[model samples]
Target: MQLVAPLNSSLRRVPPGWVYLAGLIPLAWVIWLTVSGGIGIDPVKEIEHRLGKIALWFLIGGLAITPLRRIAGLNLIRYRRAVGLIAFFYIVLHMLAWIILDMGLLWEQAVRDLIKRSYLYFGMTGAVLLLPLALTSNNASVRRLGRNWRRLHWLVYPAVGFGVLHYLWQMKVITPEGWLWAGVFAGLMALRFRPFRG
Candidate 1:
């Protein structure tokens, strides 16, 4: 296709490692804002929200890679692992911000919140789902797992669904942004079905 050529040409010029390095820019900016006291009155909440949002964006980006390659003939497979790892890194930071800054590592209260709050439960479930996928993102695991590797990575779909639900529930009122993310997640999932697999 006419569009594919230009897109592939442009992508070919940029190394996947560069994309990985560039992904750190958001983290750096967040750190700078935190140090400069620019995160407003509630720094913990701000940091947590920002990290969670970034994680979701990266998750969406990683998911998009397959569809992009299939429909647009743009192969960015090389960067999927980096995108996934960056997403996991942000997910960890998001949890840390909640545990250290928000809950002060109060296990009893944290457990109570997890049990009482649906949003917290969704978020925790999403994080737990991501743990195994993150652990096995390396090439060695892929070689060892072989066919099972694909099945293991399929966990990302549900993990992302849980993540979107977590985001929706966490919001006090569903905003347009929340709906947009949900729609995007739904569309991406739909694309994975047989009809769109072609």
Candidate 2:
């Protein structure tokens, strides 16, 4: 408690806007990789993958906020909204990169690919679910929706699960790193439901 006291104290000085600014770092890195020719031969795919991965990381961060407070007494509620919005931004970019760079804006081809690439359905589902949450992630919506806002945000759990599935399905075989992410999500969900009351 004493250790986290100082940590939480420092966090109090940091504004949520700083979190939003820091979220841009991942996008900047991707851009750097692109200019430096370090994004692989398939740059579009690389960009798409990197964006999706970063989005997942932010989503995980958003999901971790409550559990971190509950299990470790570390409060990060102030930045959860920024984290969630950044995640949605990255997801939108990922989809756009795929549509424009990968599919070249060919609607018919994109539709064909969307139908053939079954794993995309998971990502699409997650993105669709996130849409409403993102649109309503404001004070006015919070006031208007009241209790329903919390219920609507609960969609994040399934959306994240589907996002993980989308990620895992992209791999030829689920690597240990991939399994670690899935395990982390599962652990967070467990802690959420059976939080320590001590």
Candidate 3:
């Protein structure tokens, strides 16, 4: 607890803007890798997968903030919005990679894929859930919506669930990574119950 105090204090000294700027590094690196032919044979699929996985990572990170603060006495509340918006940005990029590179701007094919693919359906559902949350992430929206804003952002839990399910369903066989994320999601959700609250 003593060591955690200094760490938390140090983290508090860092600006949220710095974190937001740092968050763009992953996207930039992925773009650079794609341009430099460094993303392996199937660059398009790699790009899409990388972006989607990063988005899920950020989503999970954002979800972990509250639990981290409550259980570990670490405070990072200031960066939660930035983390969530970064996740949304990656999600958009992931969809764009699929639509532009994978589907080649073919709406009919994309729509067909959306209809036939359960993973796509789950991913799309997660995207739709995130849309409003992203739109209302600003301070103006918080002021405008008042208490409703909190209720609206609660959608993140379901959005993350769908995102995880999309990832799990996309794999032909469940990997350790899939189980790890599922366990993390389950643990985070469990922590939200009254018994776990401190």
Candidate 4:
């Protein structure tokens, strides 16, 4: 195993709230751009791109919990719920953009696109999967669901796969950046299997 770089003694002792606050940098930047007209009024591509990126970031965040906790020795358990909820937040916004801006709430056309477009179908599946996971994220649900909570959350892995595939299929040329994230995802997922788990 690789040695984890030690955080500052201060950082190791910081409160969980501060850890979450530290994680808000990217979200804050996105919001600033959205509000400052830097992203523009009719910025469909920019908006969609940012939404997809943020969704992927959240997906990475959710996936990182176990690795960070176990491998990095980072005590990331507290961040799991926060990271998961943030993922749900980005996903809801992504869906809202598609429904409100792209499709204009056109149910017939949306249904047609879902049926005809494989990438769109993959994206829709990812979004739909997020709903139940988001709903059951609370402490009450966790207490009630017990071990089954984890079983249900396993859907996030496939959701991430579908999300990346949705993007990769849509891209005219899959860039190094795309491949890098996919590689990271593959490594993370590989860790979940028996051989790599060691």
Q: Which tens-of-lDDT digit does each residue in 1-198 have in candidate 1?
A: 698889888888888789889999999999999999998898888999999999999999999999989988888888899999999999999999988888899999888877878898888888899999999988899999999999989999989999999999987899999999999999999999998788
Q: List the residue pairs that clash in candidate 4.
A: none
Against the reference, the lDDT scores of all candidates come to 0.92, 0.94, 0.95, 0.79
Model 4 Cα lDDT, one tens digit per residue, 1-198: 233434534355667677557556766777788788888767766777788788888888789889776766766676677777777777777777777778889999878867777888888888788788989988899999999999999999998888888878778899999899889889899888888664
Of the pair 3 and 4, which is ahead by lDDT?
3
Please tell me which model should have the higher lDDT, number 2 or number 4: 2
Per-prediction TM-score: 0.94, 0.96, 0.97, 0.84
RMSD of 3: 0.9
lDDT of 3 by residue, 1-198 (tens): 788889988997899999899999998999899898899999888999999999999999999999998998889899999999999999999999999999999999999988888899899999999999999999999999999999999999999999999999999999998999999999999999999899
Off by over 4 Å in 3: none
Which has the greatest TM-score? 3
What TM value does model 1 have? 0.94
Candidate 1 local lDDT, residue 123: 83
Q: lDDT per residue, candidate 2, 28-67, as tens digits? A: 9999999999999999989999999999999999999987
* Deviation (Å) of 112 in candidate 1: 2.1
Worst 10 residues of 1 by lDDT: 109-118
Candidate structures ordered by lDDT, highest first: 3, 2, 1, 4
